[model samples]
Target: MNARDPQLPLQPDEASQIGAFAQAMWDEHIVPELTHYIAIPAKSPMFDADWEKNGHIDTVLRRAAQWVEQQKVAGLTLEVIRAPGRTPVIFFEIPATKAGSTDTVLLYGHLDKQPEFSGWRSDLGPWTPKYEDGKLYGRGGADDGYAVYAALTAILALDRQGIPRPRCVGLIETCEESGSFDLPLYIEQLGKRLGNVSLVVCLDSGAGDYDRLWLTTSLRGNVTGTLKVEVLTEGIHSGDNSGVAPSSFRIMRQLLDRLEDAKSGHLLPTDFHCEIPPERVVQAQTTADILGEEVYKRMPWACGGDGGPVLPVTTDPLQVLLNRTWRPTLSVTGVDGMPSISNAGNVLRPFTAFKLSLRLPPLVDGNEAALKLKALLEDNAPYNARVSFVPDGRAGAYGATGWNTPDIAPWLSGALESASQTHFGTPVGYIGQGGTIPLMGMLQKGFPKAQMMVCGVLGPKSNAHGPNEFLHVPYGKRLTAAVAQVIAAHP
Candidate 1:
């Protein structure tokens, strides 16, 4: 009956209470605030060129801080710390009443979101929250916005049952979508205020299923930049320039060919790839088996008009998983100098530019990858037309392949399983997310000994950063209870 027992999972009554509390918190508080949050258009600093001027980032931050303060958790200390010229961080501390507890658990999340992408459902948009089928549909809800709320709610759930936990710190940043460029400074400034961390729980990751808790063990890094190609000083009539002037768009495509296979989507440059660890391959195979067709089916294949029914490069689920999580890939996210179809004229454009986003393997050196990409693209410029490849916002990959899963994961795995079974009648799942959270790599370096548990509600069909983005309300509630159980049993 001891609430402090480290060897036990939560009892049925305790789990039920936690779940109910989490549900109520989501329904009554988080969902409402999240709706307002979605409305703010709090794009990351990179996307919001006039972020400070627009005041949307500040507005969302203040709103979040206000909501956290209103929670009125006993012994809670909340602060909005601002380093000049950086997005503000929302820091919260919840004290533990355990007799001799000294360790602190750092829970990480972000408030800044990706820019509003095109192609939302007619009934849904990025900034408008819609409640449907137990999902809170909005841009940031599932991707993040729920982290601090969930973290605090979990603690409150435990407190309601008088269960003891490690002291908790909720560190929510506002620049994750922009590769978390500002986080290192905040971590350094906080110094000892962050305390001796024994566990780092991150809620900004992907889930394998809505029916189970998924733990992310690895994250790919990001290398992003712009590639520009110029052919002429000004546009000319297509008939006059036909077959004479090289199309800048065509030159751009040729430059991209130096990096990736035009047909297979493979990174042609050997330097862009790294040796995939055997353990990761094994883990991927097992996870693929667990997910089966859910691996691909979960995606909203033709959401709106953005993408079609594209077949994966491989039919083997394991290969697809490994390709996504442990390989290098390139995406041309945005383009410039291309006229809209509606505005198109019979003119050959003078220049073309593209935003290149490359996802790196977990152990690959992102800086090196960027340098190599720049060299490859700039080396043999097609037509020797003015070409430039500028690299920006490089984040090194995070790999825990050689590192042992800390003592805390087993306890959390058990908690996740029990919670999942109770809530969804399914076993918990483990995955390595293809997306990057630079904070994990930063925290790993800062807290070398800290046990890490990365979980999230961004399961398939959540479509984060895309149209119809949503938070699975039920799974979120279950995840909240699972977090409470882990904290209750943390050694």
Candidate 2:
């Protein structure tokens, strides 16, 4: 069969063929591969410090590369690139089937997983693969383990129908969960090999719901660090020090007070905030109308003392969406210098340490915000108690910056609409994600003219980082087909 023209729109029959092929591929090949992938705890370098030594990252990388090689896609070339003291990346390229096309479509994903968080169902676990009711439940499978498989499947689906596509390249990195700290080095080394990137298909984002295709319009930046306060050299009897020495925990509170409003959960530093774009605000309102109260109701809130569900900060869907996507927030993820409640005693602890994670608005510079955060927490110490804030070195000196996508080209936008309507029976939806993806900002700067299609399968309740994380297999299949349709229509 002769390859179709790249400039042409995909016919209904071609789209159907792509969808069918994607569905069959997911059932026959991708699901089993993801099942094995979920079993391996290929944690990111940040969570697993000895990632290289542990070899889990390498195992997943090698396995994914082997799978790609086994596919035997025509004109495809693959390589597993590694650098000293960095996680490995699987880079693959397939020449354009369309004549005289130099534009490249970069498909991006990550193999690394977050640390195993608690609270799985009794019958499920982070490492135990369970495929029930069209959902693949486990770590990494949805968060991103399915990406490499889905990407290749999309291209193969197009090829199987002789639908023409531009040059396609895959960059599957193992350090994305670690803020993609090592990606800069690899990007620099690859340089011209990346070609003239005209489009990027990032599968490491989230979907608003499983009903339609969702495009991540923006991403929040992240700054994480440890804040420690010391008031004594050793533990002292509470009776002896309660009235005399300052409490380390109290000092810790005072330090954090300068950064956040305990009563309102708002970050006090104005520098951390940005003026939300008018377009994004309008989009948020539209999304709020579509999602309604599901925006806040989706959170797993705990019960209160009154036997009612603990309320969220707000119930307005617009505010909820804006707060998560465009607002800066502070979270104390971990604590130290305190004994467990079961082992508690009448001792005054020597120090208090908190692992602080700060989410910055899309326009805020993360590197500068990180530096400001270090200063805010360490500058003033009550009672001369020692205080310090050390940013996470794993993210490098320049912290992870948020991304605001460039304006969508008309052709690409039309393609998204067609793909969504064809595959999902709905139009494409746009929403900003609260999570950070460091690569998006880097790619925007590197390829200023590229159109980014950042979408994924982490729909409501899929829970990417938390326990009981799952990939909605039905959504994944549809999403893969949508990707192929869009690529075939790329010009």
Candidate 3:
């Protein structure tokens, strides 16, 4: 982890000659540029109203493309591609050196980050990049920003070594945080300009605690909605309706109890169905062995004493991974139509509503899940009370990454193992990602023949999209070099 250590990797000779040079450039220039990249709060869609006015997305593209341009990559053309009303697309191309070897590899990344939420140990801020204790504290630093830098550094390193760099293309979007609504438009408008792509590298995902190159097999789909009930025309004083009127609160309780069993968090319906891939189970077992207790500590919260059946907290790692990536889960996100305790009215509210969010298994049919959930709530609601369930936004899950492509498995595995040795204390291990990246699926549709490789610097306890997000800097620098090495060796 020491920055001064020269014994790190790719011994002075076997080391990527070009990568060594790019390493100097990355440390002096790219790393500093990322500090500015992290400082901009260009939250996509969540803070879209501010985004257009702030024009922060444009600032990010400028910095990213400018950094790429400074590399002095030969035959590489960098351009800011934009269509009417859409975010800027940063494109860079390196033409083919040989006739049959002119295959294009597309690199993908996003500039917009998630909204920075409050509450942290005062050390982590989304807009502030600080290198402390060997980690880089900032937003979008690891989740993907590094991927952008790494991809460019990778191709340029090969170009510097006098190696025949593959025909390359780059795509950096500003709205990936908002499910990439403008992505289809960008691809459609520049479909031909993207050139003949043979491979893709998504630098948005994460690694295991030991720095394993994580390959996601699948991401769970999600559907969220609200369930409401009305028991009376108006609120009556609780003191006055003590024994006479049926409280809406009581009815809502009954309806929800029928929907979710408090004793067990499992959903009662058979609406969700997905057979887990055997490779995933084996991978989970490998993760359990690699992460061990740190996996348990990294979850949201856990019960300290390991209490009774109706325990207040839970912390099981293998089960946790299973619950997150493969199984279906539902949670009551928020409650509506309820007054604050400070209001202190003796009145019993006449209506109540609760927000419901569900994470579904792959291929579970989003519309089917929606209809099944609607029927479950409507049929289970208390009679004589007006009850309704309405579904809001729903996003389908992506399939597991395709690993059968030629050269991908060997190229990635070698880079990861080398990086782990040079960075962490042990070898690499694989794990599945819980969140969905829609671009992964969309790219598959546009170029079915291209190979996809996903890797990043986030690991266990390196929270993203939550309070106090950070990227491991020393590890990231090494990982960037690892990516450069991979691209250098790619056939």
Sequence-dependent TM-score of model 3: 0.80
Off by over 4 Å in 3: 1-26, 47-50, 79-88, 97-99, 224-261, 300-316, 332-356, 365-426
Tens-place lDDT per residue, model 3, 243-302, is 676767777777766656667766566666577777678778778777766665665564
Off by over 4 Å in 2: 394-398
Evaluated at residue 301, the lDDT of candidate 3 is 68
The per-candidate count of clashes, in order, stands at 0, 0, 1
Model 2, 1-491: lDDT tens digits are 24555566788888888999999999999999999999999999889988888999999999999999999999999999999888889999999988888899999999999989999999999999999999999999998999999999999998888888889999999988878888989999989999999999999999998999999999999998889999889999999779799889988888889989999999999999999999999999999999999998887889988998899899999999999999999999899998999999999999999989999999998899999888888885899889888887554544689999899999889989999999999999999999999989999999999999999998999998898999999999999999998898888
lDDT by candidate, in order shown: 0.81, 0.92, 0.68
Better of 2 and 3 by lDDT: 2
Worst 10 residues of 3 by lDDT: 397-406
> Candidate 1: minimum summed lDDT over ten consecutive residues — where?
397-406
What's the true lDDT of residue 275 in model 1?
87
lDDT of 1 by residue, 1-491 (tens): 22466445567887788888888998898888887887778899879888988998888888888888888877899999999888889999988757678999999888998888988889888888888989988788887988888888888888877777778998999988887777888899999999989888888887888777777878887788899999999999999886999999888888888888989999887777788777777878889998888787666555445455766677789988988888888898999998899999999999999998899887776667777777888886878899998776534421111112334456566666776677667877778888888888778778888888888998878888888898988888888887877777677
TM-score of 1: 0.93
Q: Candidate order by TM-score, highest to lowest?
A: 2, 1, 3
C-alpha RMSD in Å of predicted model 1 compared with the true structure: 3.2
Q: Which stretches of candidate 1 lie over 4 Å from their true place?
A: 1-9, 302-309, 394-409
